[model samples]
Target: MAKVFFTSDHHFGHKLIIDFESRPFADVAQMNESMIASWNTVVAPEDKVFHLGDFSFLNKEDTSSIVARLNGYKTLILGNHDRGRSRNWWLETGFHEVSEYPIIYKDFFFLSHEPMYMNKHMPYVNVHGHIHGQKYEGKNHFNICVEHWDYRPLSFEQIRDSVVVSEEG
Candidate 1:
Protein backbone atom coordinates (compact mmCIF):
# COMPACT_ATOMS: atom_id res chain seq x y z
CA MET A 1 0.00 0.00 0.00
CA ALA A 2 1.07 3.57 -0.64
CA LYS A 3 1.77 5.87 2.29
CA VAL A 4 1.39 9.63 2.62
CA PHE A 5 4.17 11.99 3.61
CA PHE A 6 4.57 15.76 4.13
CA THR A 7 7.50 18.20 3.89
CA SER A 8 8.46 21.69 2.66
CA ASP A 9 10.93 24.51 2.18
CA HIS A 10 13.70 22.52 0.57
CA HIS A 11 14.95 25.68 -1.18
CA PHE A 12 17.18 23.61 -3.38
CA GLY A 13 20.03 25.34 -5.21
CA HIS A 14 19.66 28.40 -3.01
CA LYS A 15 22.98 28.99 -1.30
CA LEU A 16 21.57 31.78 0.83
CA ILE A 17 19.10 29.44 2.47
CA ILE A 18 21.97 27.98 4.46
CA ASP A 19 22.83 31.32 6.05
CA PHE A 20 19.29 32.67 6.12
CA GLU A 21 17.92 29.63 7.93
CA SER A 22 21.03 28.58 9.84
CA ARG A 23 21.00 25.26 8.03
CA PRO A 24 23.90 23.05 9.12
CA PHE A 25 25.09 22.24 5.61
CA ALA A 26 28.10 24.11 4.28
CA ASP A 27 26.59 24.80 0.85
CA VAL A 28 23.65 24.41 -1.51
CA ALA A 29 24.84 21.19 -3.15
CA GLN A 30 25.29 19.61 0.26
CA MET A 31 21.86 20.78 1.33
CA ASN A 32 20.23 19.54 -1.86
CA GLU A 33 21.94 16.14 -1.86
CA SER A 34 21.29 15.63 1.82
CA MET A 35 17.61 16.38 1.55
CA ILE A 36 17.24 14.06 -1.43
CA ALA A 37 18.98 11.22 0.34
CA SER A 38 16.97 11.75 3.49
CA TRP A 39 13.71 11.91 1.60
CA ASN A 40 14.40 8.70 -0.31
CA THR A 41 15.21 6.83 2.88
CA VAL A 42 11.67 7.19 4.15
CA VAL A 43 9.66 7.62 0.98
CA ALA A 44 9.22 4.72 -1.44
CA PRO A 45 8.45 4.82 -5.13
CA GLU A 46 4.86 3.87 -4.39
CA ASP A 47 4.28 6.40 -1.65
CA LYS A 48 2.72 9.84 -2.12
CA VAL A 49 4.29 13.04 -0.81
CA PHE A 50 2.70 16.38 -0.14
CA HIS A 51 5.32 19.12 -0.38
CA LEU A 52 3.92 22.20 1.32
CA GLY A 53 6.05 24.80 -0.50
CA ASP A 54 9.33 26.55 -1.31
CA PHE A 55 10.29 23.35 -3.05
CA SER A 56 13.30 24.87 -4.76
CA PHE A 57 15.14 27.97 -5.95
CA LEU A 58 16.50 26.10 -8.94
CA ASN A 59 16.42 27.01 -12.60
CA LYS A 60 14.29 24.92 -14.97
CA GLU A 61 16.95 22.34 -15.67
CA ASP A 62 17.89 21.94 -12.03
CA THR A 63 14.26 21.81 -10.96
CA SER A 64 13.40 19.12 -13.47
CA SER A 65 16.36 16.98 -12.52
CA ILE A 66 15.83 17.38 -8.80
CA VAL A 67 12.19 16.40 -8.93
CA ALA A 68 12.95 13.37 -11.06
CA ARG A 69 15.53 12.24 -8.51
CA LEU A 70 13.08 12.35 -5.62
CA ASN A 71 11.00 9.37 -4.56
CA GLY A 72 7.22 9.10 -4.56
CA TYR A 73 4.38 10.81 -6.40
CA LYS A 74 4.72 14.47 -5.44
CA THR A 75 2.06 17.15 -5.03
CA LEU A 76 2.93 20.80 -4.63
CA ILE A 77 0.93 23.23 -2.50
CA LEU A 78 1.99 26.47 -4.20
CA GLY A 79 4.16 28.73 -2.07
CA ASN A 80 4.56 32.49 -2.46
CA HIS A 81 7.66 32.00 -4.58
CA ASP A 82 5.83 29.39 -6.60
CA ARG A 83 3.79 32.25 -8.07
CA GLY A 84 4.63 33.73 -11.53
CA ARG A 85 5.46 30.20 -12.63
CA SER A 86 2.92 28.57 -14.90
CA ARG A 87 0.98 25.38 -14.07
CA ASN A 88 2.78 23.53 -16.86
CA TRP A 89 6.09 24.60 -15.38
CA TRP A 90 5.27 22.82 -12.15
CA LEU A 91 3.81 19.81 -13.91
CA GLU A 92 6.92 19.56 -16.04
CA THR A 93 8.97 19.50 -12.87
CA GLY A 94 7.29 16.19 -11.94
CA PHE A 95 4.56 17.30 -9.58
CA HIS A 96 1.58 14.98 -9.90
CA GLU A 97 -0.67 17.87 -8.92
CA VAL A 98 -0.31 21.56 -8.15
CA SER A 99 -2.74 23.42 -5.97
CA GLU A 100 -3.09 27.20 -5.65
CA TYR A 101 -4.54 27.31 -2.13
CA PRO A 102 -4.95 25.36 1.05
CA ILE A 103 -6.77 22.11 0.47
CA ILE A 104 -8.68 19.93 2.89
CA TYR A 105 -7.53 16.34 2.92
CA LYS A 106 -9.78 13.53 4.06
CA ASP A 107 -11.99 16.38 5.22
CA PHE A 108 -9.83 16.51 8.33
CA PHE A 109 -6.41 17.97 7.55
CA PHE A 110 -5.87 21.32 5.86
CA LEU A 111 -2.67 21.54 3.80
CA SER A 112 -1.11 24.90 2.96
CA HIS A 113 2.14 26.46 1.81
CA GLU A 114 1.99 28.90 4.69
CA PRO A 115 0.96 28.49 8.30
CA MET A 116 -2.76 28.75 8.94
CA TYR A 117 -5.08 29.07 11.92
CA MET A 118 -6.53 25.89 13.31
CA ASN A 119 -8.57 25.06 16.40
CA LYS A 120 -11.15 22.53 17.46
CA HIS A 121 -13.88 24.76 16.08
CA MET A 122 -12.18 25.26 12.71
CA PRO A 123 -13.05 21.71 11.61
CA TYR A 124 -9.72 20.69 10.06
CA VAL A 125 -6.19 20.15 11.20
CA ASN A 126 -3.69 22.56 9.65
CA VAL A 127 -0.57 21.02 8.20
CA HIS A 128 1.74 23.63 6.72
CA GLY A 129 5.19 25.03 6.12
CA HIS A 130 7.01 28.35 5.25
CA ILE A 131 7.72 29.46 8.85
CA HIS A 132 11.11 27.76 8.70
CA GLY A 133 12.41 27.34 12.26
CA GLN A 134 9.78 29.51 13.92
CA LYS A 135 7.24 28.01 16.27
CA TYR A 136 3.50 28.29 15.89
CA GLU A 137 0.77 28.83 18.53
CA GLY A 138 -2.36 27.14 17.28
CA LYS A 139 -3.50 23.85 18.81
CA ASN A 140 -4.11 21.74 15.72
CA HIS A 141 -1.44 23.36 13.57
CA PHE A 142 1.63 21.35 12.60
CA ASN A 143 4.69 22.61 10.76
CA ILE A 144 6.23 20.17 8.32
CA CYS A 145 8.99 22.51 7.22
CA VAL A 146 12.29 20.85 6.39
CA GLU A 147 13.83 23.03 9.10
CA HIS A 148 11.60 21.33 11.64
CA TRP A 149 11.78 17.72 10.45
CA ASP A 150 15.51 17.14 10.02
CA TYR A 151 15.08 17.69 6.26
CA ARG A 152 13.17 14.45 5.74
CA PRO A 153 9.58 13.89 4.72
CA LEU A 154 7.21 12.98 7.57
CA SER A 155 4.76 10.13 7.35
CA PHE A 156 1.07 10.76 8.00
CA GLU A 157 1.26 8.74 11.22
CA GLN A 158 4.09 10.95 12.45
CA ILE A 159 2.11 14.13 11.79
CA ARG A 160 -1.03 12.77 13.44
CA ASP A 161 0.85 11.58 16.49
CA SER A 162 2.44 14.98 16.92
CA VAL A 163 -0.93 16.60 17.17
CA VAL A 164 -2.08 13.99 19.68
CA VAL A 165 0.95 14.59 21.83
CA SER A 166 0.53 18.36 21.67
CA GLU A 167 -3.11 18.09 22.67
CA GLU A 168 -2.30 15.89 25.63
CA GLY A 169 0.49 18.12 26.85
Candidate 2:
Protein backbone atom coordinates (compact mmCIF):
# COMPACT_ATOMS: atom_id res chain seq x y z
CA MET A 1 0.00 0.00 0.00
CA ALA A 2 1.09 3.58 -0.61
CA LYS A 3 2.00 5.88 2.24
CA VAL A 4 -0.38 8.73 3.05
CA PHE A 5 0.53 12.33 3.76
CA PHE A 6 -1.39 15.41 4.97
CA THR A 7 -0.58 19.12 4.78
CA SER A 8 -2.24 22.49 4.42
CA ASP A 9 -2.05 26.27 3.93
CA HIS A 10 0.88 26.50 1.56
CA HIS A 11 -0.36 29.84 0.18
CA PHE A 12 1.98 29.50 -2.71
CA GLY A 13 2.97 32.71 -4.58
CA HIS A 14 1.43 34.90 -1.92
CA LYS A 15 4.08 37.30 -0.72
CA LEU A 16 2.13 38.69 2.18
CA ILE A 17 1.65 35.30 3.79
CA ILE A 18 5.08 35.68 5.28
CA ASP A 19 4.28 39.13 6.62
CA PHE A 20 1.41 37.87 8.75
CA GLU A 21 3.48 34.97 10.01
CA SER A 22 7.22 34.62 10.44
CA ARG A 23 8.40 32.16 7.79
CA PRO A 24 11.74 31.24 6.26
CA PHE A 25 11.09 32.56 2.75
CA ALA A 26 11.30 36.21 1.78
CA ASP A 27 8.83 36.07 -1.14
CA VAL A 28 5.83 34.14 -2.41
CA ALA A 29 7.49 32.57 -5.44
CA GLN A 30 10.29 31.26 -3.33
CA MET A 31 7.84 29.86 -0.85
CA ASN A 32 5.90 28.18 -3.61
CA GLU A 33 8.99 26.61 -5.15
CA SER A 34 10.34 25.45 -1.85
CA MET A 35 7.09 23.76 -0.91
CA ILE A 36 7.00 21.95 -4.24
CA ALA A 37 10.58 20.84 -3.77
CA SER A 38 10.01 19.68 -0.24
CA TRP A 39 6.87 17.80 -1.19
CA ASN A 40 8.65 16.04 -4.03
CA THR A 41 11.43 15.03 -1.69
CA VAL A 42 9.15 13.48 0.89
CA VAL A 43 6.27 12.14 -1.21
CA ALA A 44 6.49 9.51 -3.91
CA PRO A 45 4.27 9.24 -6.98
CA GLU A 46 2.19 6.45 -5.43
CA ASP A 47 1.71 8.22 -2.13
CA LYS A 48 -1.58 9.87 -1.26
CA VAL A 49 -1.45 13.45 -0.02
CA PHE A 50 -4.17 15.50 1.56
CA HIS A 51 -3.82 19.25 1.09
CA LEU A 52 -6.23 20.77 3.55
CA GLY A 53 -6.53 24.26 2.10
CA ASP A 54 -4.98 27.42 0.67
CA PHE A 55 -2.96 25.54 -1.91
CA SER A 56 -1.83 28.61 -3.85
CA PHE A 57 -1.64 32.36 -3.89
CA LEU A 58 -1.93 32.71 -7.65
CA ASN A 59 -4.83 32.26 -10.07
CA LYS A 60 -6.06 28.86 -11.19
CA GLU A 61 -3.61 28.64 -14.07
CA ASP A 62 -0.59 29.03 -11.86
CA THR A 63 -2.05 26.77 -9.23
CA SER A 64 -2.54 23.98 -11.77
CA SER A 65 1.05 24.26 -12.91
CA ILE A 66 2.37 24.02 -9.39
CA VAL A 67 0.11 21.07 -8.65
CA ALA A 68 1.50 19.23 -11.67
CA ARG A 69 5.04 19.65 -10.40
CA LEU A 70 4.32 18.17 -7.01
CA ASN A 71 4.32 14.47 -6.16
CA GLY A 72 1.53 12.15 -4.99
CA TYR A 73 -2.22 11.82 -5.61
CA LYS A 74 -3.76 14.86 -3.96
CA THR A 75 -7.10 15.35 -2.21
CA LEU A 76 -8.20 18.84 -1.28
CA ILE A 77 -10.37 20.19 1.51
CA LEU A 78 -11.47 23.68 0.59
CA GLY A 79 -10.53 26.57 2.81
CA ASN A 80 -12.01 30.04 3.05
CA HIS A 81 -9.61 31.31 0.39
CA ASP A 82 -10.60 28.61 -2.07
CA ARG A 83 -14.15 29.94 -2.57
CA GLY A 84 -13.41 32.43 -5.35
CA ARG A 85 -11.93 29.78 -7.62
CA SER A 86 -14.31 27.63 -9.65
CA ARG A 87 -14.80 23.92 -8.94
CA ASN A 88 -13.60 23.13 -12.45
CA TRP A 89 -10.28 24.74 -11.68
CA TRP A 90 -9.63 22.30 -8.86
CA LEU A 91 -11.05 19.31 -10.66
CA GLU A 92 -8.63 19.60 -13.58
CA THR A 93 -5.57 19.84 -11.37
CA GLY A 94 -5.31 16.11 -10.54
CA PHE A 95 -7.09 16.35 -7.22
CA HIS A 96 -9.10 13.25 -6.43
CA GLU A 97 -11.67 15.06 -4.33
CA VAL A 98 -12.50 18.51 -3.00
CA SER A 99 -14.86 19.60 -0.26
CA GLU A 100 -15.44 22.09 2.54
CA TYR A 101 -16.17 19.51 5.23
CA PRO A 102 -14.41 16.62 6.92
CA ILE A 103 -13.29 13.28 5.51
CA ILE A 104 -12.65 10.13 7.50
CA TYR A 105 -9.65 7.96 6.75
CA LYS A 106 -8.66 4.96 8.83
CA ASP A 107 -8.31 6.14 12.41
CA PHE A 108 -8.46 9.84 11.71
CA PHE A 109 -10.75 12.60 10.55
CA PHE A 110 -9.42 15.18 8.10
CA LEU A 111 -10.55 18.73 7.75
CA SER A 112 -9.13 21.32 5.37
CA HIS A 113 -9.77 24.07 7.85
CA GLU A 114 -10.39 23.58 11.52
CA PRO A 115 -13.87 22.73 12.77
CA MET A 116 -14.68 24.40 16.03
CA TYR A 117 -17.63 22.16 16.86
CA MET A 118 -16.22 18.65 16.37
CA ASN A 119 -14.07 18.54 19.47
CA LYS A 120 -16.14 16.34 21.77
CA HIS A 121 -18.05 14.38 19.16
CA MET A 122 -15.17 13.06 17.08
CA PRO A 123 -14.21 9.52 17.98
CA TYR A 124 -11.03 9.28 15.95
CA VAL A 125 -8.06 11.60 15.66
CA ASN A 126 -8.76 14.90 13.97
CA VAL A 127 -6.18 16.06 11.46
CA HIS A 128 -6.46 19.61 10.23
CA GLY A 129 -4.51 22.68 9.24
CA HIS A 130 -5.14 26.42 9.13
CA ILE A 131 -3.02 27.35 12.08
CA HIS A 132 0.71 26.77 11.74
CA GLY A 133 1.89 23.83 13.90
CA GLN A 134 4.34 25.86 15.89
CA LYS A 135 1.61 28.06 17.35
CA TYR A 136 0.38 25.36 19.67
CA GLU A 137 2.45 22.98 21.76
CA GLY A 138 1.57 19.97 23.90
CA LYS A 139 -2.02 20.01 22.70
CA ASN A 140 -3.92 17.19 21.00
CA HIS A 141 -4.15 19.21 17.80
CA PHE A 142 -1.25 19.06 15.36
CA ASN A 143 -0.17 21.96 13.22
CA ILE A 144 1.83 21.18 10.09
CA CYS A 145 3.79 24.41 9.87
CA VAL A 146 7.13 23.77 11.37
CA GLU A 147 10.37 25.51 10.38
CA HIS A 148 8.32 27.38 7.74
CA TRP A 149 6.53 24.84 5.52
CA ASP A 150 3.84 22.29 6.23
CA TYR A 151 5.06 18.77 6.84
CA ARG A 152 3.50 16.27 4.49
CA PRO A 153 1.17 13.49 5.68
CA LEU A 154 1.99 11.96 8.99
CA SER A 155 0.14 9.09 10.62
CA PHE A 156 -1.88 9.31 13.80
CA GLU A 157 0.95 7.58 15.60
CA GLN A 158 3.36 10.29 14.55
CA ILE A 159 1.02 13.01 15.72
CA ARG A 160 0.00 11.38 18.98
CA ASP A 161 3.55 11.22 20.18
CA SER A 162 3.82 15.00 20.09
CA VAL A 163 0.38 15.73 21.46
CA VAL A 164 -0.79 15.82 25.05
CA VAL A 165 -4.34 14.81 25.78
CA SER A 166 -6.37 17.13 27.88
CA GLU A 167 -6.81 16.32 31.56
CA GLU A 168 -10.39 17.50 31.80
CA GLY A 169 -11.70 13.99 31.53
Candidate 3:
Protein backbone atom coordinates (compact mmCIF):
# COMPACT_ATOMS: atom_id res chain seq x y z
CA MET A 1 0.00 0.00 0.00
CA ALA A 2 1.12 3.55 -0.68
CA LYS A 3 2.04 5.45 2.47
CA VAL A 4 1.05 9.01 3.27
CA PHE A 5 3.74 11.39 4.58
CA PHE A 6 3.79 14.96 5.87
CA THR A 7 6.35 17.76 5.74
CA SER A 8 6.71 21.48 5.31
CA ASP A 9 8.89 24.63 5.21
CA HIS A 10 11.56 23.52 2.79
CA HIS A 11 12.60 27.10 1.91
CA PHE A 12 15.00 25.86 -0.75
CA GLY A 13 17.56 28.37 -1.99
CA HIS A 14 16.96 30.50 1.07
CA LYS A 15 20.45 30.88 2.43
CA LEU A 16 19.44 32.94 5.43
CA ILE A 17 17.36 30.09 6.76
CA ILE A 18 20.41 28.33 8.09
CA ASP A 19 21.38 31.20 10.37
CA PHE A 20 17.87 32.34 11.09
CA GLU A 21 16.76 28.96 12.38
CA SER A 22 20.22 27.87 13.53
CA ARG A 23 19.92 24.82 11.30
CA PRO A 24 22.62 22.19 11.71
CA PHE A 25 23.68 22.51 8.07
CA ALA A 26 26.75 24.53 7.20
CA ASP A 27 25.03 26.25 4.33
CA VAL A 28 21.95 26.38 2.13
CA ALA A 29 23.33 23.93 -0.45
CA GLN A 30 24.10 21.40 2.22
CA MET A 31 20.67 21.85 3.78
CA ASN A 32 18.93 21.40 0.44
CA GLU A 33 20.93 18.32 -0.51
CA SER A 34 20.44 16.74 2.90
CA MET A 35 16.70 17.40 2.86
CA ILE A 36 16.40 15.85 -0.61
CA ALA A 37 18.30 12.81 0.50
CA SER A 38 16.27 12.47 3.68
CA TRP A 39 13.00 12.78 1.76
CA ASN A 40 13.96 10.16 -0.82
CA THR A 41 15.24 7.76 1.82
CA VAL A 42 11.77 6.97 3.19
CA VAL A 43 9.37 8.01 0.45
CA ALA A 44 9.18 5.79 -2.61
CA PRO A 45 8.14 7.03 -6.03
CA GLU A 46 4.74 5.41 -5.54
CA ASP A 47 3.92 6.86 -2.12
CA LYS A 48 1.90 9.97 -1.35
CA VAL A 49 3.39 13.07 0.33
CA PHE A 50 1.66 16.10 1.68
CA HIS A 51 4.02 19.08 1.59
CA LEU A 52 2.26 21.53 3.84
CA GLY A 53 4.07 24.45 2.19
CA ASP A 54 6.73 27.19 1.90
CA PHE A 55 8.25 24.86 -0.69
CA SER A 56 11.03 27.13 -1.98
CA PHE A 57 12.54 30.55 -2.54
CA LEU A 58 14.16 29.65 -5.86
CA ASN A 59 13.09 30.58 -9.33
CA LYS A 60 10.45 28.56 -11.16
CA GLU A 61 12.90 26.52 -13.22
CA ASP A 62 15.01 25.74 -10.21
CA THR A 63 11.99 24.85 -8.12
CA SER A 64 10.75 22.54 -10.85
CA SER A 65 14.08 20.77 -10.91
CA ILE A 66 14.00 20.16 -7.17
CA VAL A 67 10.44 18.81 -7.34
CA ALA A 68 11.35 16.39 -10.10
CA ARG A 69 14.26 14.99 -8.13
CA LEU A 70 12.18 14.09 -5.08
CA ASN A 71 10.21 10.88 -4.62
CA GLY A 72 6.44 10.47 -3.99
CA TYR A 73 3.23 11.84 -5.47
CA LYS A 74 3.14 15.29 -3.88
CA THR A 75 0.18 17.37 -2.75
CA LEU A 76 0.79 20.94 -1.66
CA ILE A 77 -1.10 22.95 0.96
CA LEU A 78 -0.15 26.54 0.34
CA GLY A 79 1.65 28.51 3.08
CA ASN A 80 2.06 32.23 3.74
CA HIS A 81 5.11 32.42 1.53
CA ASP A 82 3.38 30.37 -1.14
CA ARG A 83 0.83 33.13 -1.71
CA GLY A 84 0.63 35.35 -4.85
CA ARG A 85 1.50 32.43 -7.11
CA SER A 86 -1.35 31.07 -9.16
CA ARG A 87 -2.63 27.58 -8.38
CA ASN A 88 -1.53 26.51 -11.85
CA TRP A 89 2.03 27.56 -11.05
CA TRP A 90 2.23 25.04 -8.22
CA LEU A 91 0.80 22.19 -10.32
CA GLU A 92 3.16 23.04 -13.17
CA THR A 93 6.01 22.83 -10.67
CA GLY A 94 5.18 19.11 -10.18
CA PHE A 95 2.71 18.85 -7.31
CA HIS A 96 -0.01 16.27 -8.03
CA GLU A 97 -2.44 18.65 -6.30
CA VAL A 98 -2.59 21.98 -4.48
CA SER A 99 -4.81 23.28 -1.69
CA GLU A 100 -5.42 26.76 -0.27
CA TYR A 101 -6.92 25.64 3.02
CA PRO A 102 -6.55 22.97 5.64
CA ILE A 103 -7.52 19.46 4.50
CA ILE A 104 -8.84 16.79 6.77
CA TYR A 105 -7.14 13.47 6.28
CA LYS A 106 -8.55 10.06 7.18
CA ASP A 107 -11.29 11.94 9.06
CA PHE A 108 -8.90 12.67 11.89
CA PHE A 109 -5.95 14.93 11.14
CA PHE A 110 -6.35 18.52 10.05
CA LEU A 111 -3.53 19.23 7.65
CA SER A 112 -2.47 22.85 7.24
CA HIS A 113 0.57 24.92 6.38
CA GLU A 114 0.22 26.86 9.59
CA PRO A 115 -0.56 25.36 12.94
CA MET A 116 -4.18 25.62 13.96
CA TYR A 117 -5.10 26.26 17.58
CA MET A 118 -6.73 22.99 18.40
CA ASN A 119 -7.45 21.74 21.88
CA LYS A 120 -6.53 18.34 23.22
CA HIS A 121 -10.17 17.77 23.99
CA MET A 122 -11.04 17.98 20.32
CA PRO A 123 -11.43 14.75 18.40
CA TYR A 124 -9.30 15.96 15.52
CA VAL A 125 -5.59 16.70 15.51
CA ASN A 126 -3.91 19.58 13.72
CA VAL A 127 -0.76 18.65 11.90
CA HIS A 128 0.99 21.72 10.65
CA GLY A 129 4.24 23.61 10.06
CA HIS A 130 5.37 27.31 9.86
CA ILE A 131 6.77 27.26 13.38
CA HIS A 132 10.17 25.81 12.67
CA GLY A 133 11.74 24.03 15.62
CA GLN A 134 8.92 25.17 17.86
CA LYS A 135 6.81 22.76 19.85
CA TYR A 136 3.36 23.56 21.13
CA GLU A 137 2.24 22.03 24.46
CA GLY A 138 -0.48 19.59 23.41
CA LYS A 139 -1.29 16.38 21.55
CA ASN A 140 -3.91 17.87 19.30
CA HIS A 141 -1.39 20.27 17.74
CA PHE A 142 1.68 18.99 15.93
CA ASN A 143 4.41 20.69 14.00
CA ILE A 144 6.10 18.96 11.08
CA CYS A 145 8.55 21.70 10.15
CA VAL A 146 11.66 20.53 8.35
CA GLU A 147 13.81 21.77 11.21
CA HIS A 148 11.81 19.73 13.70
CA TRP A 149 11.52 16.49 11.72
CA ASP A 150 15.25 16.09 11.02
CA TYR A 151 14.65 17.59 7.61
CA ARG A 152 12.72 14.52 6.54
CA PRO A 153 9.14 13.75 5.64
CA LEU A 154 7.27 11.74 8.27
CA SER A 155 5.00 8.80 7.49
CA PHE A 156 1.45 8.75 8.85
CA GLU A 157 2.12 5.81 11.10
CA GLN A 158 5.23 7.48 12.43
CA ILE A 159 3.09 10.42 13.41
CA ARG A 160 0.18 8.40 14.76
CA ASP A 161 2.54 6.41 16.94
CA SER A 162 4.49 9.43 18.09
CA VAL A 163 4.75 10.48 21.74
CA VAL A 164 4.35 14.10 20.76
CA VAL A 165 0.82 13.90 21.99
CA SER A 166 0.32 14.13 25.72
CA GLU A 167 -2.26 12.31 27.82
CA GLU A 168 -3.00 15.57 29.61
CA GLY A 169 -3.08 19.18 28.49
Most accurate candidate by TM-score: 1
Better of 2 and 3 by lDDT: 3
Which digits, one per residue and each the tens of the lDDT, describe model 1 over residues 1-169?
Answer: 9999999889899899899999999888889999999999999999999998888888889999999999999999899878778778899888999998888887768999888866568977789888899978877788888988889999988888888897899
Window of ten residues with lowest summed lDDT in model 3: 160-169
Clashing pairs in 2: 5-153, 6-153, 133-143
lDDT of 3 by residue, 1-169 (tens): 8999999999999999899899889988898899899999989999999999899988889899999999999999999988879788999999889999999999778999888878657777789999888787777877999898788999998887773445432
Instruction: List pairs with backbone clashes in candidate 3.
Output: none
Alpha carbon deviation, residue 37, candidate 2 (Å): 0.8
Give the Cα-based TM-score of candidate 2 against the true structure.
0.81
Output the lDDT of residue 138, model 2: 30
Tell me the whole-model lDDT of each prediction, alpha carbons only.
0.89, 0.68, 0.89
Per-candidate TM equals: 0.96, 0.81, 0.94
Model 3 residue 162 CA deviation in Å:
1.5
